[model samples]
Target: MRSAHRAPRRLTRRHLLGLGGIAAAGVAGLAVQQLRSGQAPAEANTSPGRAAASGAPSPSAAAGPQVVAKGGGTVPYRPGRTILGSYLALEGKAFTESIALRRRQTGRDQRIVHVFYDWTDTLPARIAGLPAGATPLVSWRGSAYSDITSGGSDARIARAARQLKRQGRPLLLRWGWEMNGDWYPWGAARNDKDPGAYVECWRRIHDIFAEEKAKNVSWVWSPNWNSAPVAGWNSFEALYPGDRYVDWVGVSGYNLHRETPDALFGPIYRAFSARKPLMITEVGSMDRGGRTKADWITLFAQWVEAHPAVGGVVWFDTDTHPGYAEKWRIDTDADSLAAYVAMAKSVRFSG
Candidate 1:
């Protein structure tokens, strides 16, 4: 991990432009002006954003790094190693510790902790407490519309970024992830939604972060794989904000669809090849009614070898946010646990 207090580096306009397909989105000046004016939301629509953590239960800080650190600077994560991770609630340390013990028994060395923070409830407060040298990989705008900005949500985000800059570690900030799918608040799958507006708002947030000299950070652009494809929900790539703004490209998928992992991994890999280093950022085995856990483990290993560009995968291991078939409780499968360890020892992001 890099230090957060280092002097900031300016990302040249040309540098950002070369990232990909961004100019077509016309992202300049849109979000900044909205913030300068301090426009308030007059009428909150049914589809508009929600206040922070409105419906979700308060997270307990029991979750911790599954694989305890042997030393500082770098833990034992590598490519091909099974990444034994979970979508951890920021407050749950006990749950994290238990999960960590289970992973250790299987010999898994990598553990990626995920925190889904509500933009309205979490963004301001959480960023304010970022410790020195710790730039957290925050998944922003979960289960709420309050953080979803059409144009006016810039100042708040700027404040958050400033706090993150003080933390000194390069922040792997993944905002409004899985936006191309309709399952969450930020998704573009419903109502006369505008991908253009989404892109415009995304750029504004990016610009604000940049302006704050939040240089110790990289942006990850993610979207869900639309199974049972809807009319506009064919693929997430169509809603891509452009290459310039994205450092990592990922998809949220599981193994329950009619399409097998062998069949599904390749096309997505090919499509996102335009951007190097892809990930099944969120994954699990869904459906498979009464299927033994061993089967899913086999499928997981096979999926990784089949797709080399898939640099990492963060398994969602909670009993909530059920996917199509709902496999959150599949963590009990011993075979799956072994597979996770085997893969974590081999595949890690060294760069």
Candidate 2:
């Protein structure tokens, strides 16, 4: 069933600053490397010098499940193992504090920390301070599809590519996510209802990254589970940028009502799981009607176990606007927190 309400636009660092009229944070020590005219960096390798320069774990670092793709230059995709991750809002110390609390409660370090970024925003220097071994899944919002395809945003796009390349480690980059929905400007409905424009826009950005040789990034093409307009034009197939442009296939499915994980994500899985690794890039549930949030969490774990192709799941564990009537934070109470802890501790998620 289609959602009656569109998924809320997530608050990012830029949004918070814009709302409060605060100055944008400077890039600080994060430097953007100069790109040679037409040359891109070499494809990923496991060299000691390369690893050290990129902030990747040295050979001596205690190795858990590898998130890096086998041949270097792709996302770490572990078959039969799923990685657990979360998106805690980046407000002051709350990001770090919440992460620490999760670790303390779950006895497991989150494999990924999701953060959102505006098209014009610089890569925040604070990303360097993420807990050891955590990869940052950056959800980058884009401008108009025409603006990007017409070369109007080339400078901004290249600058962002350079910054990501400078990061030097493997990270997931999800751009123009949830485009199947009508909420964001980049969505098909907002962009003249032309799905082809969305494809062209996506390819343009991916090509720019390729030109910069930002090979450390794994491109995640994500859509909301249900289309907003629920029409043929906005279907998942129409919005997809094709396999060559995407490294990971993902969907944002939230349990706003009493839907089970299968009900929320099964269609997406059947459609795209065979094409590439799947990631539930954004997922959260609230206790609704008569269902308990803890029971939903337990069922979600079971769903992941049954669906072996799902390589990762990032929980949207932050309280959102009250108008949405959703408190998505996992640790809302003892029972809910315990269920989440059990899910985290399960061997199925040990990626």
Candidate 3:
């Protein structure tokens, strides 16, 4: 009845010692606050104006179902031209790749990339290494997802929200994304495989963010495909917190388990259709499957085009799996690339 992974825990001494590489990574994390800034380190020749701009709000804004207040004013969430960007590994590559992708999407003309801000690395102790107003990290580990104060503390969440506001960027935050399944500590079914606590935790996280006046943030609530025996109708929605906290409805799905694109993604599309914008936060066809990248792209495009409510889809570019290697590439699969290009160009971005 359970099928998700748990959040990675602090490494043990043996693993820390044996896995010297990861140990160094941990230390590296602690070594410099700059590294946690979520952007490339500052250069010696940098100008002060640019540095100041880092603290300003980001220009890339979108529309969604939720509304946030800025300077005591309210705004709605709208979908933008979002490219599925990776964790830190793809941060730098985003600039070049995003530009190329944008160029390719000229026919469609959407101007944005829906990015994944890997909390551990990007949300550092200080902004020394980050660009300014970058992605903020709100995690679901501990009881943060189910018990607001259990994992995510109000103070910490407040600080992150304040920092993002100061930087002047709109945040598309997906906290404890795939909660229905059991892999993560915040998974809905963890204790008794029930979702009550999970919903409580989600509500709590929302309270903290809202009270803190983190106006530039847009919350995206996403869960993996419902593979549990009950077809994923877990009680997670009980914790929705409300339309106040959520701006978009999203799904972290893949072309795994013989799921038809529509079947796998339909529930979410229907669930949040009237209340919020919808997105495919993470998805890719695996290589091990008989499906080829071109075929997957065609299928995905055909499916997306059929859904008028679906605002956008962001492809998870990781090639870590078999059939997925060529999936995220912008050029390898001509058909897929062309489809993305077309969509990007056609969509109207929300600022």
Candidate 4:
């Protein structure tokens, strides 16, 4: 694992996007309403001018729900079963030891292990340290969109793809995730706000992986639950690389404040649940504002049960920084750990 350096609090994506503010201002109430009504909030303007300014395709050109390609590379959809997983930060601890501790604490075997790599980093050999039968969900960050689409990153991408193929086991590859947000270099907001560039970049990499015959890899396309800029152009619809290129649709959502699972994932479930196998690619919560994490986890389990299209969830179970306001680790407290254990051990999440 790479050195554990935390992003400064001031520059954190959630803080910059005012998600906390939304929760503070009663967005959770609206989210509950949305969940009950099976409706999403009104979308932003999709006018041609806005699309052009953001370098996104017009709504007419954006792809909607359609029949997607299926094959050995895709994850098998199980209607009522979800794979429970987690991303463990090194945080000065040995990776294998950390996994062992997590297993002992949760009392359930994680089916997926989440790992991250930068655009220039090689696939770490340490993946072999993961528990037997656990699949790896690799979140590979990308460089600038133009750099990628222009073939400048081909060698690097092909190298990773070849490495994955050598693994000889099914793996989930999430490339350039959270592109709707402004935090990463590959995000549309940083790449001339051009969602088209993002799509091109993704397709180019997917093609390179195909050229490498990485058939064991399942492509995962993930975005933040809400756009950072909160604009139509940055919406998931505008940034989608289309169903044919995506094996799974995922979202990163966190209850940084008082937001509930319905508030965090309702809109995403409503939009793409029918189009692709949906997963909560990244999720966590902070106990705050008189809300208990235990109750929140119970509600989240119920929500997933009510929505059958969701087949996987990866918890962001790490406290990245000291004194962080959001203690995301599942075992932050005994109650939180108990709640997570119950969720992980439940038949619905049992793989």
Among the numbered candidates, top lDDT falls to: 4
- The residue-level lDDT of candidate 1 at 258 comes to 26
Candidate 3 C-alpha lDDT tens digits along 1-351: 000111233322121111011012222232243335542221111111111111112222353433222211122333332333322112234344544444455433222233333333234232222323233322323343423546646666666566656646554567766665545555555545556666666677667767877676667777664523132335335435567666667676654432345545655665555566666766665443322444555556656656655554655443222222233444445555654454344443212
Q: Per-residue alpha-carbon lDDT of model 2 for 181-253, expressed as tens digits?
A: 7667888978888999999999998999899888888999988766666666788878889878888888877
Could you give me the TM-score of model 4 versus the true structure? 0.82
TM-score computed on alpha carbons, candidate 2:
0.78
lDDT of 1 by residue, 113-140 (tens): 4555556543432443232333345677
Question: What's model 4's lDDT at 164?
Answer: 85
Q: Model 3, stretches more than 4 Å misplaced?
A: 1-147, 150-152, 227-236, 287-291, 320-327, 346-351
Superposition-based RMSD of candidate 3 using all C-alpha atoms, in angstroms: 16.9
Q: Which candidate is the best by TM-score?
A: 4
lDDT of 4: 0.71
Show how many residue pairs clash in every candidate, following the order shown: 39, 2, 41, 0
lDDT of each: 0.47, 0.68, 0.45, 0.71
Q: Considering TM-score, which of the candidate structures 1 and 3 is the better prediction for this target?
A: 1
Q: Least lDDT summed over 10 consecutive residues: which range in candidate 1?
A: 16-25
**Candidate order (lDDT):** 4, 2, 1, 3
